[model samples]
Target: METDRKYLFTTRIPVRWGDMDFYGHVNNTVYFRFFEQARVEWIEGEGFRVGPDVPTGAVIINADCTFLLPVNYPATVLVKMYAGQPGRSSVMTWYELYVEGDERLYATGSSKVVWMDTRTGKSVPLPDTLRARFD
Candidate 1:
């Protein structure tokens, strides 16, 4: 968990059986999918457009996750998003994952989301609306 993080958004994703690896746990890579799903849902819920056609939007520069416990099937993952202080063009976003209705954290992760001009594929200043949320 990150201290001094601004609560941003959250979403729940059901874990599909196919998400499991041979070891019978959710694939390590699936954690990132959960993170991305939460991030996109929040961003869109905030009324920011995302996609190649958008003139300006978000891009992930990097992401990482720490698996604290195994996630099994027939579970819904609750992803709660938090944000670090905003910079000129980017913010550090954190996520805490738990099985819905469970107190134990399954994982924690973070990603750097940069505001960008999609056409140019270059970073842009954070949108005022986005920066306001971090404030």
Candidate 2:
């Protein structure tokens, strides 16, 4: 658990049998899905929706994850998400995965999402409302 940084949003996700690989550990790709879910939940929780009609939303430009420990099924994981460095048109979203109720870190991930205008399909600065939520 990274104590120095405060996470604005947290979610509990149950590991499904299908998330495991032949080695009985969660597949590496599943971590990305976990990160995506956490990001979407955080966005919605902040009173923002990502859709065609929304004037401003984000499009993920890059994503990366580092696996620290193997996770098995029948376990719930805690995903903590927060904003990292914010740029004029993009922001880095950070994520930490932990074993539920434990301080041990299972993985860490990040994604760079660029704000865009849905109608014009062009990059745009982060809306003041969204930026305030991150702050």
**lDDT, candidate 2, 19-85, per-residue tens:** 9999999999999999999988888887889678888798898999999999899899999897765
Model 1: per-residue lDDT, tens digit, 90-114? 9999999999978998899999999
Q: Which regions of candidate 2 deviate over 4 angstroms?
A: 1-6
TM value for model 2: 0.88
Could you tell me the C-alpha RMSD of candidate 1 in Å? 0.9
lDDT of each: 0.93, 0.86
What's the TM-score of each model vs. the native?
0.96, 0.88
Model 1 alpha-carbon miss at residue 123, Å: 0.9
lDDT of 2 at 103: 86
Residue 117 shift from truth in candidate 2, angstroms: 1.8
